[model samples]
Target chain A: MSDTPAGGGAGTRRRGRPPRTESADTRDRILVAAREEFSEHGYEKTSVRGIAKAAGVDSALVHHYFGTKEQIFEAAIAVAFAPTLNAPAAIADGPLDGVGERLTRFIFGIWENPTTRKPLLAIVRSAVNNETAAAVFRRLVAAQLLRRLAEQLGHPDGELRAELAAAQLVGCAMLRYVIKLEPLASADLEQIVARIAPVVQGHLTGP
Target chain B: MSDTPAGGGAGTRRRGRPPRTESADTRDRILVAAREEFSEHGYEKTSVRGIAKAAGVDSALVHHYFGTKEQIFEAAIAVAFAPTLNAPAAIADGPLDGVGERLTRFIFGIWENPTTRKPLLAIVRSAVNNETAAAVFRRLVAAQLLRRLAEQLGHPDGELRAELAAAQLVGCAMLRYVIKLEPLASADLEQIVARIAPVVQGHLTGP
Candidate 1:
């Protein structure tokens, strides 16, 4: 609620030099702040002003960069899944025989990173109960990842197959990272990839 | 805050005689009431009094029957997963080769039931964001189901394998039911079973 600035404004303009576009660093800071806020307080309780304050920028700047809370949330999801958003392309480069392994490795690889896991865990946790958050998460997965992959597969029920594949991976992530269910939570990475790859391969290549 | 008796205590003592045990009908009524209250308001917001009111009983009766909200929540999870808790046995009754189909069919069967699905969804949704609910839900899955299944597998990384298998099915359920991701949401039952059963079987029987 306070009209606080994210940065001192002095730091952003200390050189008194104008850049052609908004500083990427500033925008990045806002995104990071938004992610933290949304993860902690959830979608409903988080406010742009709160995010701006945490980001050390004015609320107007947050507004200018991301129009609405929904927009900011979408951006957060995009950032969280950024590494794997183009997973279809990554899996395509791989042979069909090992597509499951490649896809499993790629998706889990992003999830294994501490840097990305935090926001993702938060989003997954929130999306479980909140429809709006789920919608954004669903849109990204269906549009950017799964459906894109499904289109490339010239098979019957490709969409359903693609989703089943996604479901397996999503479920694994849910249990391993989000729920931290025993054994799976502490299982070695290569071990999981070894077991799950074939299932994914089946979903991708199977009729 | 209101003092109310469940079922007017009339059905239990129509002959004006005390019963040997708590009325099964009364206990069942409270459970149904608890499920609705917890689903709608979530764990923290749901109170004994509220549940009692919904069941048309006194808050003291809720406490007398269930001890605490946590206990009641645990009962709810148990009831929701009853069909699948002994899934190993259910699957065992069938051929090992078709175990995946049996398992998948069993879990989805429970999920498809409207009576069970409502409370299960609430618990699953609540568990995502709420640690306490998650813990209760987790305990039931780990101890009663997945871990039990793992113990019987007697394979290398058996527990992890069991969980990965669970992740596949759970993830599918989350997307199809909880998140309601489409194509998946509308996909035919046998089709999904055909696709997912192999993955589940692979996890169970594979190395």
Candidate 2:
């Protein structure tokens, strides 16, 4: 299983047009390698060389794809956190008053999406185990998600309340996805959002 | 720093008939060691031997102290979580229907105590990074803390609501302690709890 191909043989059987430099593919390969390395060995322990080796690509290719390890990590984080970050916008772009309903629906919708949730779990796991990774997680969550939410609220303590709301949301995620707490683990996403959204909305919009 | 005396020479200067083998103290030391180890390395990487080494005792002594790594971890968790676990009881035991205020005061008070907060932060950080640690965290938080709060509420969804409130409180702790977000990083405890507790109480006992 360790020797299993990382990306499946689909890459090997390319027949049409030789794929125009394969930069995007190589970048993705490096990202997958970085995620595995960071998850398994932690951020401090995972190196560019290690990621390159895992990706089965040359070190120069890895560097070419990402300027530095920090860049690679930033990319990994962007991918991992894109769902949550994208949520506020999705909710905001919709009807305004039901922001609570929309936000809750969007947030839980991401958690219910396996493709998004699995990477989130991995990112959360990595953050817990590694300081650098935790820092990355913090930066992404705070800057991209929380700050925007705070800005949207425009209350005097908007930032703090936004963070508090984030804490509640993320904690729910931790319990539901990571811990797999009973009833909650199997609970319907719509039900959860409906139940929890008002509370989150209260934090975001209440006095 | 690594070579510095374990407890700043306090370990060597202890006198008085070898101190009555206070199992609590020994158990406490072992738990503290386990907390640090688990925080730094997560559950899988944190070994009994490593904790023992950090605690300046033999690996056998660790077993004698706590029987097994899991037991040691449980002890550590109990210690780390004692504040939150005990808070519901404290609040319930207090006078009258100010349960929300009492609970909020108790919860914030624990976060303010450095002795408690440090280990709790470690546990939270560990839970984020490791599945077993996360499970242990969930079990303890839900069984010991949230259940008590839920039972006290006696509402239909009291249990779920308690869990939600617990998540909010813990999430606040995560941001204040682990993520160290600004303003919140320096917010007054009384102000925060006062503002947030009513919301929690609403979750606990509302229409």
Candidate 3:
């Protein structure tokens, strides 16, 4: 049996590492490194070894934490989308009539958060560059985020409507934050949400 | 000064070389080579020498044709967007009431065209991956395409609305063609356009 951490040995416990209090910390470290690597090099070029190296851990340790590169990437994206995903529920708890304003505000607030925005930019950039990254991004948007948004709206074509809403929101982010187009780029977040939210709301609940 | 082709020296012209014709051919060749190079290797990895080699021309010829890599990329994108730029006019000439169908057909036609689609995929991929590429793409979309669509629509918020329409079209393309998601990936073009065009036209014409 090979002594390497990644290679499983006969009669050895499948879970090699004993549970540690710092398990979450190690997982987060791997995620951070993966985000940076994926952002800079994209999915096709980014390797597990490379992420492991960046995280200052053995490749096997990375596998121990995330299992595979795709799994790690999914986890990273889940984390990235969490704020937006959770926002709808939070906004729903508020006034239903002001859903548009609340939704837009929630979106802009999350995007304006630097910690969230930077990793998101990386994911967005990487997704555009590589097919694999794009697939992951699309899945998250379609399955998790858009699906939830559609469920909230409860329209007949809610899925499609939700996707359109997402496209508008994401497209604005792409231009303002990632691409940094003029005028729109410099516009205040509040101004943007105020202007655009109605359109999003119309899509969500219009006839 | 320097005798290199890129330097544009004032020395005696070569006899019987047909400088103008050769230069034009070189420029076209470089653009073609650049499209393929950028598509395959992306903007960062593609080089002038590599493009020149692909074109079977001298490196100096590439520089002479296009001043820099950035200029070449811009030219390539301009070429890619050309199909869409002319599309509005073509669709405009058709029945005004069926503008949505005409527009949808035109967009799907271009995206379905293998010749155009490959380079487009490259451009989109690069734009998503690299900041420079994203900036260039955003500028092209904003200035040329979105502005024209807005002008044609003659809406009060034409610019923003046009951008919103563009986001729908581009986002769908990104998912169907680039990401190759289920259902959308295999769905018939007519069905997709039928479903999507009204939404797009709504953004353009408004109720």
Candidate 4:
């Protein structure tokens, strides 16, 4: 709560205290507003003031919760991609064969979900347009997530193979969701899985 | 050139009309400028005036050469992707087995060249950010180019297969060029060709 400090400290307290949950609630609201603003206007145009207005908070509170715009944008990407960020761990470690299917199912399933799709789309669109957003996106996706998957394979060229696999899915997302290219855009999910899964499997385990 | 276009009627021209090649050169310069502006500022923020300024021409000339910003954007896409737009013909009426190799070689070959890479990057980036740009990009890539490749394959789910193949390549382009992700970006073109050609071949000719 804004009014209460974890420990009694000078310049940390106010007369009235709000619940800890209330502070989290405010943070969530600001994050939601930030996502919307970033998605719509992208990184360059979005400002803390605009997000604060949208969240019905003072600009100072946005800075308090998230130190800077870059920090806020990073937080937004983390939240949006949180569903898939843990995906490398989702694949059961064993035979290398079906990693592709599990990976595709998890990644595409998140995109297919209406609730997650909205924020993911915003983050993607923002990343594509803004260099700062793209840098953060690249680090999360390439450095953190896919590279981890590559390491799990324990194969030579694991990183390259992992990236190629990622490329296929990212490309699929770019078309099916972002650009909404036809056929792929309208293709049945099972059909997509059937068609693409082997190719992914090949990338992961192929010589 | 600027003087000649203003009040010329019935073949009456100004004192030293630029050569036909000069006119073509001017048009090419404008296209280059449009690509840069669109890529940098995106479709919504990029203006004909900005493009003209970048090209060192009057805004009126941009309108004259390419009526609207949309038309200019379309022209930019055409110029940028021209190498790959006709790629189905480049593969010849060969066995489906190597069609993937030929296609990959042709598609990635364009990106490898510094000349074409600039505009292609612009179009790809703009498409990722702007809906209108994406629509135009989708039509050019899907309807004009890729769908035709699918038709040539004459396989059941030919379009789907074609798009899957495209997704592989497009995804590679996104990572290697646009996002510049890790080893893929710096990987030898031949190495990329060796690695991805089979996956593309699989998507195209695989049962």
Comparison by DockQ, 1 against 3, better one: 1
List model 2 lDDT by residue over A1-207, tens digit each.
111233445455455523333566677778888877876666667799999999999989888878888778878768777778887688778555577677777877888898877777777666655567667777888788878888887787888887766777877887777767655777777767866788778777877
Model-by-model DockQ, in order:
0.72, 0.46, 0.25, 0.60
Ranking according to TM-score, highest score first: 4, 2, 1, 3
What docking class should model 2 receive? acceptable
TM-score of each: 0.83, 0.84, 0.78, 0.86
lDDT of 3 by residue, A1-207 (tens): 122444344555335654333566577788889888876777778899999999999999999888888888888778877787786577667655677778777877778889888777777777776667777887887777767777887787777666555555766676677666555677667766765676677666766
DockQ top scorer: 1
lDDT of 1 by residue, A28-137 (tens): 78999999999898887789999999999999999898899989999977997787787888889956788889999988988999887888787887677678988998
Query: What TM-score does chain A of model 3 get?
Result: 0.84
In order, what is each prediction's RMSD in angstroms?
A: 5.1, 6.2, 8.3, 5.5
List of clashing residue pairs for candidate 2: A128-B129
Q: What is the C-alpha lDDT of each candidate?
A: 0.81, 0.74, 0.73, 0.85
Q: Any runs in candidate 2 off by more than 4 Å, and if so which? A: A1-20, A40-42, B1-19, B22-28, B95-97
Best by lDDT: 4
Whichever of 2 and 3 has more lDDT, that candidate is: 2
Worst 10 residues of 3 chain B by lDDT: B1-10
lDDT of 4: 0.85
Calculate the i-RMS of every candidate, to one decimal place: 1.2, 2.1, 3.0, 1.2
In angstroms, give how far residue A85 of model 2 lies from its true place: 1.8
Positional deviation of B53 in candidate 2, in angstroms?
Answer: 2.4
